[model samples]
Target chain A: MDYTKQIQEIATRLFAEDKIDVFVGYRLTGFDDNQVPALIRESKDVPLLVFNQKSVFNLSNYLKNDHTRNKRVGLVVKGCDSRSLNLLLTESQVKREKLYVVGIACEGVVDDAGQKMQNCLECMVPAAVVYDELLGEANMERRFIINADIQDMAAKELVQRREYFEEVFENCIRCNACRHSCPLCYCAKCCIDQETATLYNGANTTSSAFHALMTWSLHLAGRCVDCRNCEKACPSHLPLHLFHKWNERVIYENFQEHLAGVHEGDRGAFYKYSMQDPDDFIM
Target chain B: METVTNQLVSIEKPEIVAPPDWQPVIIGILCNWCSYAGSDLTGTSRLQYPPNIRIIRVPCSSRVDTWFLIKSLQTTADGVLVSGCHPGDCHYISGNYFARRRFLVTKKLLNFVGFHENRIQFSWVSAAEGPKFAKVVSKVTEDIKKLGPLHLYKKENFEK
Candidate 1:
């Protein structure tokens, strides 16, 4: 799963050909095996770029940042990262013509503990769906595995479920780290932050967390790429993936087995509706 | 200086001791073209119904953001009724269809986070279905009454 030398060559070539102004990849933190996202602006720093299982941060998140916005970008993409990139392209947040994407057929990425991420273990798309130079063996198969937490929650009593989530929300610090880490949360002014916390209900901890999480999940209902950027960014380590995965399951069953940003020009499940959409939930 | 804000947040809502006459507060959000007009018909036709609902009008069902429901439960309303035009009956073509997708997800999402599934509801009422609108409101009000008040996160507020 190591493509360090290959990525460096492509990045060096892209810079040499004057095709990209910035190359977004992963670099060693100068101390650990784990890599931090590197935004390389000069060809001399192309050696800094690395691609491996430890490259956990989704580089596409930087596409919306000021450094790369409206600039030519040569970047790397794994399966999940490409999906997020696909969404950004569809949403018109980033133009396709202004970038050169080096795709990777990811096996899986590991966390600090060297364990494969939960989302990767259940990944359906294992290849870079959109890339200019793919880096690994591309295998796209649907691994429709329902997460244990969501299934277990479904089997539990409503009271127990509520009690569990109450703790989850109560622990929230409202630092807005999850929002900043989400690439799709690209609104010039975020809708959630537009209103003061006081304007919501009160500036209480659990209430604000509940409001923020619910609002954030709904905003990303169909478009989330399951990259775990928000989960990684949360200081409290909230099980944020549950919200997105739950919505994904519901949408998959009810809305014609739709997966977000899978096909080109796919406007997400919420944007377009089918006449066959379930109306039984309505009274 | 916090006008129209956080007063709901500061109310440390106590447990519901249902008095013999404590009617549940139901917030009814209706789309202008269909459900709103249907409620108007309910009034004009002298239809007798429970007066528990507080109606708010929106241009279309899709205009109702997900936060509106979350805020309603966290603050004042015991229950919410979001009614829109039936499929293919939308005044703005397919507004309700898009809204319908969101409504289902929002309902399930809220339920997943701990609220009873019945606390938030949805229906499609055409402009001609005045009686149907009355029936829906009564059903929603009844469901909320049984579920009691939304007692989650009604703690004391703080200055952010």
Candidate 2:
């Protein structure tokens, strides 16, 4: 779980060889145990790059930023971050030849309170799926466990669930942080931000929040890697994973347990269809 | 004269829901080649069906974005019906197949967020199936009616 020296050495080597113009990794926040992602452009700053249990922010998201865009970049990735990176690769958002990836066989990153995040506990792929050089023992055990919160919500009555979600959406401030934080939502002009559309017209109303979040979730339905970037980015700290986990569970059961970006060049479930897809649900 | 006016009004708007007359507005987004043409056939065949549905045509089932469904439910729709070609029958060869995956996920996601599972439904209707189209509409209308009016995420309720 501690690869600080190894990562520093790797970044030093990558920079010394002029292999990458940018190295996206983590650095101490100087405030707490939490680490902030740092984009190191010079080898002199390579000493600042750190990787440990507290490196919670998915660094792959930095690849989509201007610091790494169109630049020869090297970045760190955990199991889930690597999956989202694989999606970004499959969608042709980033050219593979232009980047070098340092993968970590993730032991799960911890939150500010130092507890392992929920997704990592249920993580099936603890090793980087797509990587040049992998660190730590690669364990790709596939564990499928439905989250308890989803089960509890499903058991509630329709009225109860509706009221709960209404309050959740009503509290939304429509900041669009979640969209920017997601690596897969790379469109230059997002549909949710369309001013012409009266529904998601950048309003802070519950109706707009419902539209924006629902549309955003559907866009990431089969592709979401449970990275929790959107949840982490939300200022309100809305439990945004509910939308993603529900879709993930449904896609898994209905589409033969298809996980996003598990295999190279594999598209999301929505992109590829099977004749075996459940048809009884459709009248 | 009063009886004559009343009968005339009823005949002109025969599709109106009876009794309380508060018909649930269902949005029907039909793919151009199959479902839309099938609806056209239903019209030409003069088949009687519920008028609660408001049909919007698209190039194919895959052309219908997930936002379309969400926007409808947010704006004025009580329920949504997305109809495309049958499996292996998409004019675009695999449009409906891809769309089918999205529909199932979107339907379930909306349902998971507390919308009724029946609030959004999907179907496959070919151009030749005029009677089948009517049957599907009536079934969806009836299902939505029984579920009552959709108040979830409506702008009127939450507008500032």
Candidate 3:
């Protein structure tokens, strides 16, 4: 599971071969074993490219930033990050030819608590969906499981469910960390921004959080790769994953078991249609 | 528990029936080419439909952002109905096709979160089928009437 030395080797080779303009990976945060995503521009910095359980941030987000835009990128992706990479390619947010992806067949990463992340626990795609080279063994046999939290939420009464979300919303400080951390939230000017919003303004009201979170979750309904970046970014530690996983579960059930980023070049759920799509709820 | 008692207090019979002259506010986001034109045809043909819905005509059904529907439900509307051209018949080729997928996910997610699914609805009504448009409206109104007020995130006007 320690791919740090291998990542450094590959990054050095890619740099020597002139295969990439930049390498996006992780470096240890100062004073901690935890890693912070590092964008290595020169070959000398390739040694900073490390991959282990603490390599948590999804590097595909940097592809949208100015640092890697239009530059040939050699990047590392865990199971979930690769799916988002597939989506980024599909959405034309990043050109596939420009990316030299080093995929990881993840054995699940741990949180700060050293506990396995819920996303990794239920991960069906333990192998990178798209990559130039792969590390670790692919477990294609892993079955997809609906998150237990979603099942528990579904069993609650309507009022109880509302109350649960109210608590989640009330705790939100309206910091927009979840939105900023989301790789798919690549909009130059997000509608959730108070200055550009037509619905809810920038105020940190509970109602604004309700609107922003609902809008944010809906936008990611078919595209979220369950990277947990949004949840991790939230200072309130809002179960932001619940909003997303709830949407994912509903889309999975209603949209012919459609899972995002599993297949390369797959259009988002809302970008395609099927004859069998459920419409009984339609008038 | 405190919540259990609160729920008991809130569950009084909600006067399910809409009083006479009390029309349910249903916001209808209709695509200009199909559902809106079809609604117009209903007027031209003197065909009657429930007057409860307030139509906001967009260039295409795809233009109806899910947030707009959610906003309507949270603000004033008791129900939201989004109508578009039949699949493959969108004025903007694949607009309704994409809209179909978006609406389906939004509807399912809202329902899963305990918002009554019946409050928001979707349908395909062509411009030629004025009667079909009327039928859809009648059915949507009836369903919303049964559900009564949504009582979601009603906020007072800020600046506008």
Top-scoring candidate (DockQ): 1
Off by over 4 Å in 2: B1-19
Error of 3 at A201 (Å): 2.6
lDDT of 1 at A277: 87
Across all models, the iRMS values in order are 10.4, 13.0, 6.5
Candidate 2 residue B68 Cα shift, in angstroms, is 1.3
Per-residue lDDT over A1-283 for candidate 1, one digit per residue giving the tens place of the 0 to 100 score: 9999999999999989999999999999999898999999999999888888999999899998889989999989999899989998988889999999999999899999999988998888889889988887776566766566677666676677778998999888888899999988888887766755564443647877888888999999999988999999999999999899888878887888888987878977899999998898797
Give all candidates' CA lDDT scores.
0.85, 0.85, 0.82
Once fitted onto the true fold, the runs of candidate 1 whose alpha carbons sit more than 4 angstroms away are A195-197, A200-204, B1-17, B155-160
Write one digit per residue (lDDT tens) for candidate 3, span B1-160.
Answer: 0111112112223324556766789999999999998999999999999999999999998998989987887678999999999877988888977787788777766665557667788998899999999999999998887777666555543223
A86 Cα displacement, candidate 1 (Å): 0.7
lDDT, model 2, position B49 = 96
| Docking quality (DockQ) for each candidate | 0.32, 0.31, 0.31
Error of 1 at B69 (Å): 1.0
Tens digits of lDDT, candidate 2, B122-148: 999999999999999999999888777
**Candidate 3 versus the native: TM-score?**
0.88
Scored against the true structure, residue B78 in model 3 reaches a CA lDDT of: 90
